[model samples]
Target chain A: MPHREKTRILLVDDVPENLLALEALIRRDDVVVHKAASGDAALELLLAHDFALAILDVQMPGMDGFELAEFMRGTEKTKHIPIVFVTAGGRELNYAFKGYESGAVDFLHKPLDAHTVKSKVNVFVDLYRQSKVLKHQLETLERNRQEQEALLQELTETQEELRKAITIRDEFMSIASHELKTPLTSLKLQIQLRQRYLKKGDASAFTIDKIAKMVESDDRQIQRLIRLIDDMLDISRIRSGRLTVHPATFDLSELVHDVVDRFSEQLAAAGCTVTLTVPGPVVGYWDHFRVEQVVINLLTNAMRYGAGKPVTIVLEAGDGRARLSVRDEGIGIAEEHQARIFQQFERVVSASQIGGLGLGLYIVDQIVRAHGGSIRVESALGKGSTFIVELPVEGNRASDAS
Target chain B: MQANTLLIVEDDPDIRACLEEIMVSEGFEVLTAAHGREALQALQSAQTLPALILLDLTMPVMDGPQFLAELASGRWPEAWQRIPVLVLTAISEPFLAGGVAEVVRKPVDIGVLIDAVARHLPVSLS
Candidate 1:
């Protein structure tokens, strides 16, 4: 409630002298008095102000004290105001009963007792002030309850997110253990076999061709271990927001060509070939090393799952963006698995068959995003997949926006 | 004398190669398959039943458990089911498979693996 300096009371009487006398008795610096000669005029005042009390004269020319009190009772805004009826009649006339019937809190005789009137008005004013203070306190409590409810809802959502993160962490640990153990097993067995030959004094096991093959096998396993460890490091860097993109101007076509040229030996080993469809020099400003990493990841995936089929690389640039896509016609991913492939440790095929850490596409996605670029896949089961990436031509725009 | 033959079923090419090399050096004729479906095909077409089998649990197109279930479904001769299978795996869970004689965790000790294979063989390799 707004702070009010004075309490207001209505005084309605036919004679101006009677109203003035009553007002003088109850009026104080903290009290405001409104006087009216008729019931209609008093009602007008009643509708305009919130009064603490209303004292009505019984013998008015129109609308007597009892009738005015009934009117105030019927009105929603004025209904709660305490009514006091002042009449010149004696106790035998029973005006007090009628005044009480019309909802008057008290009755006053025309030979008004000044102390009683002043004291009654003061009591009503104090009651109104106390009720207003109580209402203010109730509003404060309701607002605090609502605020607490909102905070509890936020906490529940955060807890659910934390639970999901922990599950992912646990799953990643298991997969990592399994993948790392595979190469270690191969290495251990190879070395044990060589050591046995050495113990048996078998010079035949160290023949030029046999030693070359052993070195090759060891190198392959070591490379596989190195690749898995690098992927794990990349994931940690991405999660920690430390995957920085240092942008520089370069031709995307040349980069694709270079990546393809480098992957030629791997492609042939997998019995796969590449088809490049670069119209011209599609140039852009992007992180050179990171973009090369993206290319290598995608191309490696293409060859790995391409089922010895031809892989296609396409590049185009226009309207401040460069688009690169790699398409393979091998065993494709199902629609449901396509979206999840870019997430951490997600693979469409079994780990036993493919022999991967399942972080290739995820790392590729993070690298692309760090360069203010986006990656998406269009694939269906057994029809093959096309991975598309789009990057902004502007240099370091991702960092600039942040 | 029963022929000393071993069938190896696995998907990873490198691991498959290593297993083949180890078995061949041990004076055993080995038949290899990339997955369960291929292993089944090889078994159906073979002239003689292998004395023992080495199986990896996880694979594409078909898996070890699925293959074992098929082998026990009366699709092949009763002699085929008699061939003991040694399950070699990296998975850290207890697996259930029909006709699995023993389970060996990978990074397997060669002596332990050989002893297990010998115990399941109809006639031990010389």
Candidate 2:
């Protein structure tokens, strides 16, 4: 997939003249050549750099060609490189004996044959090229293995983070439950104590007022805590695929009316009005309870953003899909947040003034999908936003491919 | 220093405040803290060391396991070691109190909390 490292060929000869002569013999691209003038120099070169082969001179001062060849063969690093000797006017048996004993692959005579050197060197070069390819392949595999290990490590880290998140969630649940219990206990106690005190003429005006305030405060706290716990449990059930749906055919218009009736107080508190317009009857199959949950979540969202503006719920039917649209006039969804609003655990950025866990739209999306339906949101930053949920009439029987 | 007082260690305010009210109305001197670190600190400096510690499983700084780890090695101040810690938590894993002395579940009745404290040692109401 990428480029390769160059090949290095080292030539060793005692005489400078022979070294120069040998260097000119072979010229090829993608090959690097190094020459050494003596056995010691050749050994130094071998230590400094890796070579494919050492071309040695048979005649030398301190280290004989045969001795150098033996040294190259003995040492661990230099042993693998092939050795070829250059000699002149020697007996055939002596030459053959020296070559084989000293570990020379072959000997070339001093009246240096250029073609012969080129041909033999080519053979070693080809061998060098093949080994390089194998080595490169090994390196590539190693790199890929390292990358895979890093990815696995990252995945493990993510899993650990998720585990911590779940633990925090569980801890929050326990604390929330305990908190709810305390207030409920206080409320019951206050109510009982005040009723007894009144019945027994033991209730002073001060005592009665105190107990009343206590009951009111504790009741509010209990309600808030209960709602939080319910939301948490709902998300947990939805995520684990444990939430069940009770499907039935119902008039979509009636369901919307009930949802509106339930949310009347919330709408008033939020200073928002609601309006609904629908056809006489749009028949739809859905889990009524879950559909109500979805409707409430959408209404809450509308109330939050629509703030005093009328949230309109319009139901229409066409192409075997029943469409439900909720329009809000408050600060509409920004383009960036619109994309992510349907993602689990995503909250609107910088909207902390409104308290939410960012799971409402996500839950809505899931409910819509389970009914073999789709939802689309259209919004601009400053203008009002519209969310349309379209459901198939026969959601339960729809084929997966469709 | 009184020998009988109930200790409660929890990071959450509502949980701590609720438990404090429960214990105080039950006529026991109650001590409270937000986490294991502060609990240990309070334990070390208290004019009256508590007879029992109601420990939470998780907290802000050091958690239940870390506290137990520290306590098991006996690295805590000597006075702190002798306190019988009742590991009050929502987690049912009583084994989380491996090195600690006792265990109790949260959202338990105030009467149950009092009995748990009374069973270990007499608590000071004075």
Candidate 3:
């Protein structure tokens, strides 16, 4: 959008006819010309709108142009506006000299020329128009810069807030782990003792059966709580920027296997077909735990959202980095929400119904970035989605596989 | 398995509680004292000799080094040297090699704590 601009000129002359002529001559679609028969009227006009230039007649009935020019020079507002005088043509040099002394920019003798008047007027008008354009552009640029600075400031504040939140979360996880340890420890002991006693008793007894069911439920709940606390800690490390990757020589194939093995139970429970492919023994030095975590999150998210859909795991060497990708044939990301897929709390609408806290991709992206790596996502609605991770791998070794 | 008694000496309540919980879970009869003075008194007066002492580096009264100095200097119970001393503090300043047996860190991980204690405890559970 262009700047809003308007040019205004104040014309002062005792002869009404002369004022009308000047007005009709200088009128253009872009300029607004105002006429004042008296010096007081001209001053009032100057007070209202900033004039581009003022035209004054020396031989006036009340206050002459020289007096008006002097008055204009005295006041702050009208002073900067250039003043040009109309002379009566006697002691031309003297009249011109006094005009200059009273703040006149130029002088024109009476019996005005039609062409000279139009041409001179056009020069000042063009100057006024150019300056107005420049001023408006400057104001716009300043406004845009201020808005940009405000946005950057807001971003900085949000980053700090997120940091604080991660700290709080870490504290909470550590505390929860401490609190839950006592009960879990006691329960584990109690259950072990109960198992010992049951082994000595009848294996098929009704009361034994009942006790077994209760024990199973209790054990599952304990396991779940432990998993929750552990997840919170890992995610906290990723969020708080405390998670560091220790790059070692390792096999990417083995990494994929570990990830798959960790979620084998969940995959079976979800009854999803999972395929793994890797020619990896790909070498890289990355914080193994964090990279492993990124893969785990991607796979877990896929399993939760993929439903009965097939999920593919691919590990490949690319551009000096070990790459791992998880692609799922499930509901795909929408066009509008794809850009912010890695942002926290932003679950794509397609996966909104899934049981997720929407932190998986955010954590994944963070973990990848920490490895000095990058992640990409490709999706088409209703077809499927693929999430890819690339990382530098130089010195790595495979973790033991069972 | 015979449960050996363990003494914990530290200042922070949160860290103290966390340590006790870990030791108790690992089947040790645990006793806790907050600082070095109280720990020394406990050592002088407790009915049973502890199997190990988990010491913290920084504290208000008679810090870890001072307490260790008094014990290791001379004329002290032989049990002091026998019991494995695991220093658990955040300080990373390198001292003379083998100043203490092992140094665990702050923000204790349960697995690490259990493993450290189990490794240092001399008598294996039957």
Candidate 4:
């Protein structure tokens, strides 16, 4: 799968005949020979290609072997190329020392020995190939290390997220059990009281009235249990990504009014007064049923948190967008808790104080976003909160309506 | 008459009413409060201290723990201190550390609740 390139050797001499002789002597199956007639020509070849070894003639017309070697040593590109100097001059110690000082690996005497030159060239070529392999392996190792570190970081984050999810789930289960038991206890007591009255044969008007009241109380508790179960099912649907929205053209103001009217009894019980401010009909293509759910959730939240306070709902449509705001004058959310309130199983108030699965706002957020809208809150401690939802009028209508 | 009095402290109106009716039919005088704070207020204004208190653990404004703490803090009248508390809760473990006569878990059997109340009530009152 991986292609291996041939090792290259450069032969440099001013004389063409000497270049041919050197090239012929060093040419092999694994190596490619490049012949350059002068130092300038050799430098040109070196710049264009990578060579395992360079054989240079000490005596040249210009830019001789020592000068070329010194120049190559100064340049980063050619500095590591092993140089072997070949000269027809005397076997003098000073010439050899000068060759070594100029970055030559070996110096050969005149009238060249073919066997010795080949062996020396082979040694330098082998060293160059080994170093290249080592460098490649080092690069591979570094890359593997970096990838491993990234995977480890991802694993750690995923583990932390999983831990938090488990804790929330445990807390939710505990709260759910408690919530279920409270109404169940009341329901059982109501039934037992009715049975006791019936066994006593007490058919008086007073007994009848008390029984009627207990029956009504039982109905309320049963409704609460049903709502809790419904909320749990909604959470499952949301988690499975199966929540569907069926949209149609409708007046947003009318829908808001209708939802508010449905909560009139609860609002009165909480001592909360709601004021609706809608100047005109604001039409939108959205899921009417889902939108009703959102309004109901917001209103219920307002009544629960804004007990004995005034709540206001304002609807305005302009510039291809519809905006609805629900403002409550009650105990407000803290700045840090505003964002967390929209997450599943998260509540700003303690579970003991408030009774719910804490899935209302999360389901509301999901439905609003599915309609190509955004929801946000503005609140301060003890000042109250306003939940604003803005939906696009035209865009995402087709998909939503479908 | 004072010794037969019993107090029911619970937030749920339906449950509180049901308990009160049950206790009244059992020949005991029942006083009710919506929460711990209300219970304390009722105790402060009572002409005769209740012989026993049926306390629910979780409630808004103030809970069972707060009520027990206030009762033991030596601020209430001496007669209120001797009244035994019967804890009613849905939690697995008892939330109260001390000053509780019994722990009754919900959804509690009416028979068991009534029996516990009778056992904890002062013999003079019963």
Best by lDDT: 4
Instruction: Give the Cα lDDT of each candidate.
Output: 0.83, 0.72, 0.71, 0.85
Native interface contacts kept by each candidate, as a fraction: 0.42, 0.04, 0.00, 0.54
Model 1 residue A173 lDDT?
Answer: 74
Residue lDDT tens for model 4, A208-239: 67667867778878877887787788789988
Each prediction's RMSD to truth: 4.4, 15.2, 19.1, 3.8
- What digit string (tens of lDDT, one per residue) describes model 3 on residues A89-174? 66554454343654438766678777887777778877776777887899999999999999999999999999988975664444
TM-score of chain A of each: 0.77, 0.57, 0.50, 0.85
* TM-score attained by model 3: 0.46
Best by TM-score: 4
Question: What is candidate 2's DockQ?
Answer: 0.04
lDDT of 4 at A287: 86
Candidate 1, residue A376: lDDT? 95
Where does model 4 exceed 4 Å of error?
A1-3, A36-47, A59-64, A70-75, A87-104, A204-208, A248-262, A276-288, A315-323, A390-396, A400-402, B4-7, B47-50, B63-83, B93-101, B122-126
Model 4 residue A324 lDDT score: 93
lDDT (0-100) at residue A159 of candidate 2?
Answer: 100
Q: Flag clash pairs in model 1.
A: none
The local lDDT score (0 to 100) that residue A4 gets in candidate 3 is: 50
